[model samples]
Target chain A: MESDKDNASLLGGKLSVINVGLDKFATELADHDVPVVHLDWKPPAGGDPKLAALLSKMGT
Target chain B: MDIIEKANEEAIRRMLGAEPVLINVVPAREIVPNLQDKMILHAGPPIEWDRMCGPMQGAIAGITVFEGWANDLNQAFTMAASGDIAFDANHHHDAVGPMTGMTTVSQPMLVVENKTTGNRAYCAINEGLGKVMRFGGNDAEVLNRLAWIRDVLGPAMGKALRDMGGIELKPLIARGLSMGDEMHQRNVACSGLVLRAIAAAMAKTSDDGTELSEALAFISANDQFHLNIAMAMGKAIMDPVRDIDGSSIVTAMSRNGTDFGIRVSGTGDEWFTAPVEMPEGLYFAGYTEADANPDMGDSTIVETIGLGGFAMGASPAVAGFVGAGAASEAANYTHRMSEICATENPEWTIPSMDYLGVPTGIDVRLVVDSGIAPTINTGIAHREPGIGQVGAGVVRAPMACFEQAVRRLAEKLGIS
Candidate 1:
């Protein structure tokens, strides 16, 4: 019962967020007065699985 | 650190330590080794006549006529197809050129020597804007200007350069960077600087007042006059960085109209290639994307040494001209470029980035790992021959070339 009350308190507190990959989520959060940071990210090796595997093999 | 990382550190060190100086201007045959009669050196990797793009073909024909090998463009085209004339890349001869990048035996070449390594490189004089041979203009007027450069301007500049004991390029380029020149699409500041450096020397060396006055006026009027000089400087600086055993740093990146190619330090002269991409930017009035040719030139050598687009933060004035978004966004381009490079150039720094060095020594492994290709600032030429420039813009070097380079490098090192 105490843990459940703690969870409710945590959920009600001021929110800050870190968004990665697509930035739409961060933009939406910012619109609602939430502090947010967006990280510009892309899949390694242009998202090519074979190239990514090769890169890993090369120990890059 | 690993062997690859150690080798890369050495390569970048040699590149930064290079001090390229403009020594003299002379005929191509006189300076470039093994440049034979009837041979034409062009930009990019080796390409056959049939695969040559319209602008390249046009430039070849123009050069043939300019050299008096053929009477007209039609005859020149037939001769080019007939195999009587030989063609090669400028890179094979330790030289570089812009646009179609035609370098024949008779054209005057600017000779730049790297004081650090005792290696040298060459390039042709930049023809003033409008219909010119570099962009495939082969008309009688173009031929007349070529004749003037070969007979008059070349000799005058050569004398002036020799008289002044050659100008050291490092400080000049550094000053230009601070004054809004990127040594690529925008060279106004550098051009004025070159004129200031040589004006008195040119006067002292010239016998004819009219010729000296015309030469001064010409240099002052053309904003991009310093680009060819900068190309030779880049080639001179980067040549000594080649052939390191385990280095994955890129030594060269260039494009023919059909293909874009890159050379890695570990791979020697072997080129990793992919289809070239078209540039996206603002077009001249009455022109659009359909009118533009795919990217082509050896001018990317400047970027290879971290001056052109990689230093975009230094010249916000070029941001709008190249269609690289708002001026305020220019520093972002540099910041992104930093993600893939081996190090930053301490000698050349951008003020807008709080005196941060320009990104230097492109690493093939980092490019593949991060999936960010090098951005190039370039002028758009007309797809059809002889139409000259249609626009200017920024383009991405294709990612496929970097992927291939990384694979080949890994294979060479016996990692896969």
Candidate 2:
């Protein structure tokens, strides 16, 4: 639970971001001297279209 | 504040204050001032005839036939190849359109006016899915649909709009942002809202209620019916911000099938263009990535105003179309846009952000420094002429465009 003071700090403090989808964005943010964390994300179920379809079918 | 900051603030102020009202629909030549008989307006920055991509060339050919300038496709092609017909960018004429995005003199265009700034913008009526001219369908069926939209649909819509006094689009767009429409990839809710606003007026304007109902039904079925109006509204909103001396805010982002282009407020009318990137997303059945044309359209205006891809957090359903595949990823995509924008537009709130404003006023300096280009949701036309839309997806404005604009802005500001 973040307190009011913590929330305020978060709003105006050192900027950091968790960038997914494209690594280029993360690289660019770093070039600008902005603090950022890049998380390489992929579709679930190891990106197998059929298995992911089944997982969606099971509502997971 | 510095010059850039002051200019950016002024730019954003004009954008925030815009009140787009759909006043009427009229032929492109009648409403669009100085629209000459031989001149054709297309999406994105200007390109010569030989450089235009297949879909754009195909659309020009179709428009020529529609205008009776040529009797057939071959003759139209010859006319175009010979430079008998002139081509200019839609932005140059205060107009915009979706893919292939060629607007001829006689085509009916929606006229949207910003009551706040007294600026007006025009956009062609959306021809609605499959076998449409905008997507490069130039056959008789496509031409016939254009005629119907020109003759029957345009008059009916114009009459209905006139009956209502005018339909205010800004508030409706505000409602739509909250109701799962970013007004580009998915306009289902806004389409419904427009119908609800004008359905009564539509009925009132026509004598034969059945014919009117059929037209209304056609509108009801096309979820993207409100796209042209929204685009025109964006144009109306953004036109007031152009040439604002030192503003680094992007005024336009559009693409021809071959190239993508951007214009910064401070840079006046100069365009920063780069090679277009093909969109990556699910294709319609029987279509694949190889068949996809490079992204095209003036629909990117939605993104320029902080809707389309920027408001995706509020439109979780768009995840599938843009390949996010999950609501959280869509939300993150919207959050990412804020990193490059100058400010958020409080008027257009994204519900998922706890009603935080949608990110507005894309700053070229921030974009260059951050290296994050604006994301756009778009319809993919088939690369070949006349096949129509193959799929829909997301693509980024090329980083080179932002870099180029930033360099120009820096030079203009006398900064190293």
Candidate 3:
């Protein structure tokens, strides 16, 4: 998961209303260190470490 | 017009500006658990007789034999054919049933009372997995489990309720809304709350710790037991607003063994109904589309009133049964529901709607005007009877029902 600061920075580039890749989003978030609250139901095959951080943090 | 006619007429008047609502349910029983059974307890609208697949019919026969209403499978069929037994939706009686939602007076039903209007409804417990009536498989195991629930669990809970005054589920629901439970698919928080409250009261004067522990464990294990309460709470909350004069707020969403039906508050309680179909989504291992039952039970009332699928975003985990698209569809479902509603819930709000207030109240006019049918987040069962649950999916109320409702409301309200 990315830090809140990095997440804020990456939100614009990573998030897309239609068809945004979660991997790219998670990676960008990780780069910036933004904390993701949770993961979408299906992951981007093989799962992402950023997603793990988000789930543990979110307690889902 | 006489009272009955007046009641029916009143039902019509409420259909004008129906708003949707979110209702949460909690058990008044001291201990809650997942009552394990041979069949997965399916909930919601019933399937049509002609439409029933093999499993559904089998479950019906199984229920009869389980209840001792019939001596055997052949006798059960004979009784059904003779019409000696009444086949009514749990919704009609203000009750909810799990998948395949079958119930009889003999079944120990949980009567949930909405204190606001003194309106009460009943629902049978969810028979957890395997050969349960809702899944449409009937066998000795199913019958024995039914007997156990009625003979033991029901009575024990009755005593506990008597000991610790009736419970108020309203507060728990309000709190659960924030936690992650939509009070439908994700009731983990709500379940815990129910158990905690009841166990505290039961501990005061209970038998051994083993009995108490076992009961508590049961509720913790089953995620769907609270569905009955949610259905009742929805019934209770909506009952107060039912048959309001010239109001289009929908008050009740229910299904008989054959049709999916709803009552608009301003439409004067006249039921607009349509045939039910299976919802498409994920299901248990080994269960395929062929293993499911059609929509069953009265629990749809919960979703109809706004808390079930519409609030799915709250419980992201719900993606399992309803499938992945959980978050966005949660909002989408809420948005679709808003098309039919007259107002937002002043109280309940689903966080996934970005914390937007739930689409409260189903309005007939809005439904007809927009042509966007309300989307229900539901579990899909096999089209044939007796096969049990094959998967889960989303479905919609037939558009014609709302169209007719709007037209009728227009006539009653003298709208051009």
DockQ of each: 0.55, 0.02, 0.02
Reference contacts reproduced by model 2:
0.00
- Each prediction's whole-model lDDT (CA): 0.90, 0.86, 0.59
- CAPRI class assigned to model 1: medium
- Looking at candidate 1 chain B, the ten consecutive residues that score lowest on lDDT are B128-137
lDDT of 3 at B261: 72
lDDT tens per residue, model 1, B1-416: 28788899999989999999998999998999889999999988888999988888999999999999999999999999999899998888999999899999999999999999999999999997777888888989899999988988999999999999898999898888888888898999999999999889999999999988888888898998999999999999888988999899899988877788899999999999999999999898889999888998999999998988998999999999999999898898889899889999887887777888889999998899998899899888888887777888998999999999988988898876
Ranking by TM-score: 1, 2, 3
* TM-score of structure candidate 2: 0.88
lDDT of 1 at B292: 89
Q: Give the higher-TM-score candidate: 1 or 3.
A: 1
Write down the DockQ of candidate 1: 0.55
Best model per lDDT:
1
**Which scores greater on TM-score, model 2 or model 3?**
2
Docking class of 3: incorrect
- As for lDDT, the candidate ahead, 1 or 2, is 1
Per-residue accuracy of model 2 over B288-351 as CA lDDT, tens digit each:
9999889998999999999999888889998887675787788887888998788898888987
The RMSD of every model to the true structure, in order and in angstroms, is: 2.3, 10.8, 12.7
lDDT for model 1? 0.90
